[model samples]
Target: MIVKTYQINGMHCMGCVNKVQKAFISHNHISEADVNLKNASVKLQMTNKLQLDELMDVLKNIGDYEMIENESEIHHNKFQLSTYKPLLLVIGFILFVSILSSYKTSFQLMNWMTNFMGGFFIAFSFFKFLDLNGFSNSFATYDIIAKKWKGYGKIYPFIELGLGVAYLLTIHSAITNTICILILTASTIGVIQAVLSKKQIQCACLGTVFNLPMSTVTIIENFTMILMAISSLIFDFFKQIIT
Candidate 1:
């Protein structure tokens, strides 16, 4: 077995690092791999020697980010992430339109539609989270927890539905506050996990619908939700307090 040393570039954070590592192992012949963000390097132990062209191509496929074979050896645009860029843009725009619709119309319909959209986002992420491979990915811990915890996954969609319904059914300040807190708490945990894992990997959050960069978007999107919910909650709370 030849132990080949390769470096992955353009990895800005832990998520970038993990995604590059996955790119390497996606090739079946690779026996093992170890990556370090500190050095921005990847070490691969291959089953046997292979064609250099094949090796380079496979590594490039795993990541649209840059990968360098050696120092001063730069590969430019080995893959195109531009395709996914449009998808993320669409997700953002749709979110904007959805929020805007609520502002322009009756508050009740706004609340109902927004709740459904938000719930659908969470439910969609929940499904992609399940598609994870536990052994290869760090974030796959959710899957393990869901499996052992039993019913967590099945129950979560229902919880999200409940949150949506609560918002739709009543103007309870407490309920809105609860929803905001729940979203914030969950997003905070997601950011913490992504940071701690120290690998660049697809967030798999939006699934195939929106190929947004996993970076801050996931956390940010949830943060926005939490903030909106919190704002609604605060307003409701004050209204209740005044009444």
Candidate 2:
């Protein structure tokens, strides 16, 4: 009866909590595991043959989350995130600002901003179609929604570009801002999707050049982008009727 309790760490939300759970559930040797985000510990009932080396290997790849044998060393791997998450997050922010910039004093400035946001997204999404392991990989997930909704990954980016173009052509702040905010919201959903799937890989947002860590920065950035996008969406909704 070798009952070993591991000191689990680096869980911030329900998504983080589930990732840890998935890791444990994947293994067959353990009788049961009770993982509490608040407690940050794994209660395992084992038969004394389990090796610590194997356990350590599995924990290291939990995306930004890290596991250490020594409880005191947990901080070393805590909240580590991938670089792509933040990079893509930044790209999303730029698009968001572009919508507001479209509302500048001069109509010419508005046109420039809208074109910038739309054209870039279209180009970026086009190139992204070539990469197999990038954001497109997330679409391969096995959940009901992802499985049922095929080809959806390819539609979102192009749609965003079209919205930008329409807004620019019409010089409609309501439409432009609404579209920008929608993009932001969608990106935030990406973060949620990753968390839910227990995905711990490179975000693949920067086009596969940088191998960054997936840490708390990525999560926080996702949240901030969502907030900004939501504000833009609301303003658009109001502008539509008022103007």
Candidate 3:
């Protein structure tokens, strides 16, 4: 069973709550619907998962009420550590390999960070490439540029791939790191907006293949890349200064 929480507007009293509950529970996959007029929230238990669009459609057909999903609530309830096992494992593997590789000559924090980022981008882009159409559809829902230009979503994976190769090859480090910083900074804006607005949406980090919920973790992932890029660039600047 899956539980989804949504903030309901236009509910003035118990009468409105009852109607909303009846409308939702009448749906095929929905087992129960509890609408709390006092809290302005509705909790739904469903046998099958449904997208926000689908839920909106259901409410639209019933009445003029607006159902705004509480993404933060859903993030807390639906997505657990187990739900993110695949993502965690991928990050763990990348960090392990990158750290191991960095130990070859000497331990350099910059090298380790760059290697981790290179592996992160390459592996993530691989999944996005697996089903480009699917990934683009999901990414467009939350990414700033991707939402504005659908083509950006289509080509984002390729961009990631290019960045990964540049990082791995150590080619044009300054330019590549600058590009990384810019792209991730823009991406983080959209992520922040989505989370703050409590929009229930799936994360496009691992592509549409895995149903990862958009939460603080997504924000952290983007910021991690941005931080690494900035750190490397700063280190380079200091090295030049010292010389």
- Using TM-score as the measure, which candidate wins? 3
Give candidate 1 regions above 4 Å deviation: 1-90, 96-139, 142-151, 168-173, 176-180, 208-213
TM-score against native, each model:
0.48, 0.42, 0.72
Candidate 3 lands at a TM-score of 0.72
Give residue 15's error in model 3 in angstroms: 29
Q: 2 or 3: which has the higher TM-score?
A: 3
Q: After superposition, how far is residue 141 of candidate 3 from its true place, in Å?
A: 0.8
RMSD of each: 11.4, 12.8, 7.3
Candidate 1, 75-194: lDDT as tens digits: 421334563565456466656655665676666743644554454455544544453232113223323344355445445444554665565454554765586576446545755575
Report lDDT per candidate.
Answer: 0.54, 0.53, 0.83
Model 2: per-residue lDDT, tens digit, 24-105? 6677555566777777777665322245567766667786665545455334334544424546565666667666565655
Candidate 2 is scored at a TM of 0.42
Instruction: Order the numbered candidates by lDDT, best leading.
Output: 3, 1, 2
Give lDDT tens digits, candidate 3, residues 1-243. Answer: 456788988888788888888888888768899889889998887544567778777778656888787979645665577878889999999999998897767897788888888899999999999878778777777788988999998999999999999999888889999999988888889889988987766778887677677788989888988988999999989999999
